[model samples]
Target: MADFNPGRDEVEDVAAMKREGDLSRFLRQQIRDGQARRDKPTAAPKPAPPPGYRPGAWPSGTSPPGPLPDRGADWDRALDRYRNGEGSDRDPCHCGACDTPDNNQTEEN
Candidate 1:
């Protein structure tokens, strides 16, 4: 028959219980407690931290700074340019995705 070998502390505890003539009672209570523990519902796992999360980098009740607020007039001007078909005041983006022949043609042409 397979036997469960108790650890040293448990062996000592069992020996003490045996001497006190209550080893069976102690084991029955331990078994009940173990079953109770196994039957209890487990809590949900904690969520993983977000990418590049740094613990305690900011103070409690405060968060890291967010994106800067848009400059109202600058946004209005840029929106107007888009509405009027006027290109951006800044140089045209040369990224291949939106490259156009018209973007290459200058006012001197």
Candidate 2:
């Protein structure tokens, strides 16, 4: 009768090779061969800027050099223009309650 060889024998051989440090030596030799095959040292790529980096301003998490300017007067001027009917005909009135065409007419006319 022919002898039956189980799959465990192959696994046992691998374990024995690993225990004897043969596997590590084989891996080291493969790495050395790969390194020798390369002709040039590859330059590492430059790291990209962080997500919070602004072109002309400071990065996120840091405060600006001075206090921010008050924009209340700007808002008041815009509201005054809107009330004076300075917006284009296509633009809706500032008041949300009405959509009449007369709302777009300027008082100067």
Candidate 3:
């Protein structure tokens, strides 16, 4: 068995404080601290791009290329081939014999 007490006074104090209330005061304090931290301004906004600058436009003033070509038919063909077991090289026999049942019975004669 391991010793649960790691001997951290600050952690123990916080735990004791939370236990003193129904944890409602501790939870409210956490929320208020989070909100205060978030409300503090961090950095100034980025300056706007120069006038007549088209976002993502090429240097030559051409628009960005259109969407890629559709490959749905290729995907459908691959899925169909997989479902038909076309590429599997594993042994198909579940029983001991790889041959048909008639061949097995004849060989036993």
Candidate 4:
């Protein structure tokens, strides 16, 4: 079993590092190592900006938001039939064979 000392002050060279300068230096180093991190600073991560990158700024190769489509079928009679429940009771067709190529392409086999 490993030796475990619960209340032991496990400071390395505790007598030498008693004053403010040593503690301050140690804390500053720890904070720096935790934050901007001393790794090789390469290209900024995608979806995450680097240390000094600004928001609302687009990258090198991105197009602006293009015009959105005016979606949904706007036919009056077909929409009116669906709305008024006139076309509600018809059973769904599930036959494998079809007469029209367009219908075959659209409808399932």
- Pick by lDDT: which candidate is best? 2
**lDDT of candidate 3 at residue 59, scale 0 to 100:** 56
Tens digit of lDDT per residue, candidate 3, span 1-109?
Answer: 6765646996787678777864788779888998988866679899998877777776555667899999999999888766654444431543333454432333352
Pairs of residues at least 3 apart in sequence or in different chains that clash in candidate 2: none
Candidate 4 on 7-75: residue-level lDDT in tens?
Answer: 445464443465534876776877988787657779967786576665787655676899976655556
lDDT of 1 by residue, 1-109 (tens): 6799889998898889899999999879989998988866889999998776778687556788999987999999777767544554432563323456555436752
TM values, all candidates: 0.28, 0.26, 0.28, 0.23
Clashes of each: 0, 0, 0, 0
Candidate 3 off by > 4 Å: 1-56, 61-63, 91-109
Clashing residue pairs in candidate 4 (N, C-alpha, C atoms within 3 angstroms): none
Error of 2 at 50 (Å): 15
**Which prediction has more favorable lDDT, 1 or 2?**
2
Off by over 4 Å in 2: 1-65, 90-109
Distance from true location, Cα of 56 in model 3, Å: 6.3
Estimate the Cα RMSD of every predicted model relative to the unseen true structure. Answer: 14.4, 13.2, 15.8, 13.5
In candidate 3, list every pair of residues with a backbone clash.
Answer: none
Model 3: which ten-residue window has the lowest total lDDT? 88-97
